[model samples]
Target: MKTSIYATLAAVAFALPAMAQDMGDAANGEKEFRKCKACHMIQSPDGTDVVKGGKVGPNLYGIVGRKAGSQEGFKYSDALVKLGEAGEVWTTEDLAGYITDPNKYVEEKVGDPSLKTKMTFKMAKNQADVVAFLAQHSPDAGAASAGDAAEKPATN
Candidate 1:
């Protein structure tokens, strides 16, 4: 009985990391998202762009759970549209992988196998933190307030 109990405990221990990975902290993620601000801008409280830097990458307000390439008026590659059509919603892990290597992620999902993104910046360090930040703060993060939703269109 002791041996069986030990095995059960070991199994549970092994599964804990996987469970933890699913629950990323949105607040931490918001801080880490500073890296992405160079290319993308999140919405402000008054229903305007926060960064207002440039329109290099499309606004990434509601990217999580949103249909890929569905941001209105943004010119998305056919590959991205294909990714959206495949029902491949952006989860924490998906964002991590896409940031690490866009081409590999895009190709695996769509098969075009390109090595470039509309945004030329590469996120090498603290990618998990960035995803966490974006997942929590961005409109896509399912964290919209009444004021935010009142201004922005339905994204997710």
Candidate 2:
């Protein structure tokens, strides 16, 4: 019993870092988003353009917490749609990993080795930053508290 308890504790400790990624600097993410401009854009529901760019990819407004492949009319690959159907909701950590390697991420999620994404570009270095920027624009951060809602004014 003692050995098992120790092993469990050790496993939990090691897993903490992978579970809780450090929050990236949203300001830096804004700067890093320039690279994403070639294929994506951030346009709000009210037709306000946050970052005007190409439309090769889906509009990234409110992508955080959104169901994978849920962007209406975007025509995501079947693997992505299946992943979403399997209850994959986008979290900041998952988004960071996905942006680092889309095909790999989708493959891992869908448990299919042959799956690929239309996204060819990868943001390897500033992935966390870009995710942070996207989170800022996410109107429906699924895990956020009412106090954390964007409509609420920051206290500090």
Candidate 3:
């Protein structure tokens, strides 16, 4: 009985912290994501850029479910294209990893050797904030019920 009680308490304790994380507000994320405006444009009908509005990188409007490097008109490195062809789809976790270290994630995930993705951009060190912003702001983040309502449960 003691062991069971302790286990129940442990489980509740673990769940409490997870329940406490704020999923963030998109409106707030839009403001916070302003810092990223230099590099990324998350648009719905069309994307805009302050820095020449040119297509240096792919449009990220629907990036949440999009395959890596699969934007229609943009040119992607062979590595990213290969990742797309391999049936890899972008999820929030993948986006978070990319936000943390684009080059590293591409290097580790892309199987193509000849083509290297060169996104060396680093998000602010506080990736949780970035992730929250991404999740909240992206139009294609998909199936939103509530903040992080669809989020996968935290794993040990």
Number of the top-ranking candidate, with lDDT as the measure: 2
Clashes of each: 4, 0, 0
For all candidates in order, the CA lDDT equals 0.63, 0.79, 0.59
Give all TM-scores, in the order shown.
0.64, 0.78, 0.63
Give one digit per residue, the lDDT tens place, for model 3 in 35-93: 56665666555435322322456656656656777777777777777777777677666
**What tens digits encode model 2's per-residue C-alpha lDDT throughout 5-47?**
9999999999765533456667788899999999899999999
Residue 89 error for model 1, in Å?
1.2
Please list the residue runs of candidate 1 whose C-alpha ends up more than 4 Å from where it truly belongs after superposition.
1-31, 44-46, 114-116, 138-156
In the range 1-156, model 1's lDDT, one tens digit per residue, is 999999999999998766444444555556666767776787654767644545566676656556677777778776777777877777656777888777678888877765345655566766666665555545545532223432332211
lDDT (C-alpha) at residue 67 in model 1: 69
Residue 135 in candidate 3 has what lDDT?
54
Better-scoring candidate (TM-score), 1 or 3 = 1
